[model samples]
Target: MPLSREKIAATAIRLADAHGLDGLSLRKIAKELGVGPMRLYDYVTNRSELLDLMVDVVYARIADVGQHSEWRSTVLTIAQATREAALEHEWFADLLGGRPHLGPHALAVGEANAAALSEAPAVRGIDDLQRALGALNAFIIGAVRREVTERRTARSAGTDEAAFQASLGPYLTGMLKTGRYPTIARLVIDGAHLNAEETFNHNLALVLDGITSRPRT
Candidate 1:
């Protein structure tokens, strides 16, 4: 009921979700909370701090992939959970990888991941662990960005995935007929049409495998 940092972040997130980050302002959050804009500064210093709080709130939603039987499974679970959270909070994808998240909740997620990987035989030291985590984070962030962008494109065009592809069919057909892009043509014609979830899982498994299979340094 009372104003709090969490409440402010939550309101900002909700506003961002409904509209977008471009127009998210402290004034909007204050009005949403039925308070004056200056009052919001008591909880959040500025837009940057507000963004940090929003990201932390989203990270808090990530399910704890606590202590799995194997490090790979732990990493996989965490990655999947992160992706799920980002998808739910679409603005999260845009903010992710933009800055270091040192908030309690964000640190907890990172700590849980580091602890699990540290116990693994493949993780020789801090460097290896950092590398592994970095790789996963990079992939997850990039993948989420791409997926959300596609979703936005479809929404803006008022078309579903299938229809969107159909709309591009004519241009693609002409490009493919040139015979200069044999490999790309083959991919467009034969690539597996995995849904977003399947596509993410499939690529994620490959990334995990690559990470674990690297020679111990």
Candidate 2:
């Protein structure tokens, strides 16, 4: 049977995760699918279309997530899902710009997040959706970019995150301890043991705090 579009798009997503956006090409996809490069052209016109399809596939995974009564919960679900997607396809970091419009996955994820803001009692009216969606997209994108950038920098330094920090600890610690940046030093000392999960949770809570602590009257 000829491959369905869903099959093609799903394959593209796995390819993006395995090889990133740069390494993905019609030839590469064809190889993975056990076909000729021309076979892909039958379904997708070019590499850009493939990337768009791959992103939409990810959107499909999280599309049905945020439809409940609480808007904050919706955003949290979106935040986690987007982070997972970004980490899976670290190359997406380089490919997300210049979008003509949000694809299915991106739009579905946005709808989930928008559901969260929709539940907020104070965040009513038409413009509120825009504010909520903007805040959520910014937060998720920022979190993933910081995370991937740190991982890339660590790789460039020829070490993982913990080891890189250890290698630089002496100099950085000294600068902190000597009162160059006392607050930074204290947080580093106090936060040295916090893992990625803890860090993400903390950041999520901080964002939620900002949303919740606002003047609701």
Question: Highest lDDT: which candidate?
Answer: 1
Per-residue CA lDDT of candidate 2, range 105-203, in tens? 677666567667767665666676577556656776677788888888898899999898789978887788678787787788776566775688678
lDDT, each prediction: 0.84, 0.72
Please identify model 1 stretches exceeding 4 Å from their true place.
Answer: 63-65
- The total number of steric clashes, by the backbone 3 Å criterion, in model 1 comes to 0
Deviation of model 2 at 38, angstroms: 2.5
The ten-residue window of minimal lDDT in model 2 covers 92-101
Backbone clash count for every predicted candidate, in the order shown: 0, 2
Please give the distance, in angstroms, between residue 173's alpha carbon in candidate 1 and its true position after superposition.
0.3
> TM-scores across all candidates?
0.93, 0.82
> For residue 105, what is the lDDT in candidate 2?
66
Clashing pairs in model 2, backbone N/Cα/C closer than 3 A = 59-105, 71-116
